[model samples]
Target: MRPGADIQAFMGRLGYEFAQPELLIRALTHGSIATATRPDNQRLEFLGDRVLGLVMAEALFKADKAAQEGQLAPRYNTLVRGETCAAVARDIGLGDVLKLGRSEMMSGGRRKDALLADAMEAVLAAIYLDGGFSAAEQVILRLWATRLASIDDDPRDAKTALQEWAQAHGMQPPAYEQTARSGPDHAPVFHITVRLDDGSMADAKGAGTKRSIEQEAAQKLLSRLEGGQ
Candidate 1:
């Protein structure tokens, strides 16, 4: 597709057309491909993080009238976490519009969760800057509707549950080893192994961070142990 057509399609997916199209362009620019004149999305990502957090917090508070602070915290984390943002980005095909360095593009950067998540946040910031917070809030609610509807009132993350389970079973805390790393430097994949003291273990790979990959492995192990797999 032509560049203008591609951006138009992306705007349609994001549900917001930037008044300053340059903001959208900057939001999709990766650091590896940025220059002095063409800045990356890092600053936009920072602003977007705050904007998203505020939107999510407000939404959660209004949605759960009876929820206490403790009750709301986990749901907040689940909603704003990088993994969830990456999923949202994928849902809107954000990767296809991203501007990556040659090396990054060659290494499948378009499918990398970290890059997609960051870009998604930058795009949110762009929307906020282009229109205002109200615009950003509307976009977030529409894009995150399914996730918002599916949250448990007080859900524990996999890492926390895994640690509790290990302690309960008299095993030392689970150990996570970085078993493998692949892909280009700009967008690497992590393979992590989570092992119990008794030698039972699980391993999983993810396109996000090492910590996220380890959490995924732990979740898999927990599911297997709980017979939910």
Candidate 2:
């Protein structure tokens, strides 16, 4: 069966035409709206998770041939994590084509990170099933090209790095405090401050999620400490 106009538009953004249109349809169908006839994307999500993992692992291995397993593992995790997948899904406007129930729609399901990430994986699974691993690899590589190129050599996030720095200095783990929160429930902004035992502190504000704001704060603090501030 042919996809609808909206799904076709999504396919244009996704950069792959589906031979089995039903697979794409299934991939986009969320559990909240699913029925016996129209199943959800959970199983495909499972398969796609593994597919994404393998692709990222191989890419990282080839990208840094001399890197040890410990180094490559974190890079692989950075690429295949849910946050990265959701970022890619947003790039292709996957949320616009998601089939959601009324409750989920009212709750801003389209903007949710987890939902988008799962659907992205499910869609990749559909691509793999429709055109095999080579086609799926081509699509994955194209979509992730920029991220793969710019991925940091140090895979540890700012928070982890900050804690490690403190440990090496014989200090306690840095503390993060949410100093403020604003905006509506669906799109809230967070203000986070990371403080060290030595009274050094850094603050950062961001929208999307509190954890991200905290990470930004931690990064700022880490940078300051590393810069001899």
Clashing pairs in 1: none
Task: For candidate 1, write residues 47-98 as lDDT tens digits.
Answer: 9999999999999999989999998999999999988999999999999999
List, in order, the clash count of every candidate structure.
0, 0
TM-score of 1: 0.86
Q: 68-116, model 2: which lDDT tens digit per residue? A: 9888877888899888999999999999999999988887789888999
- The per-model lDDT (C-alpha) reads 0.91, 0.91
After superposing candidate 1 on the true structure, give the runs of residues whose Cα lies further than 4 Å from its correct spot.
Answer: 1-3, 167-172, 180-192, 204-213, 224-229
Error of 1 at 47 (Å): 0.2
Which model scores highest in TM-score?
Answer: 2
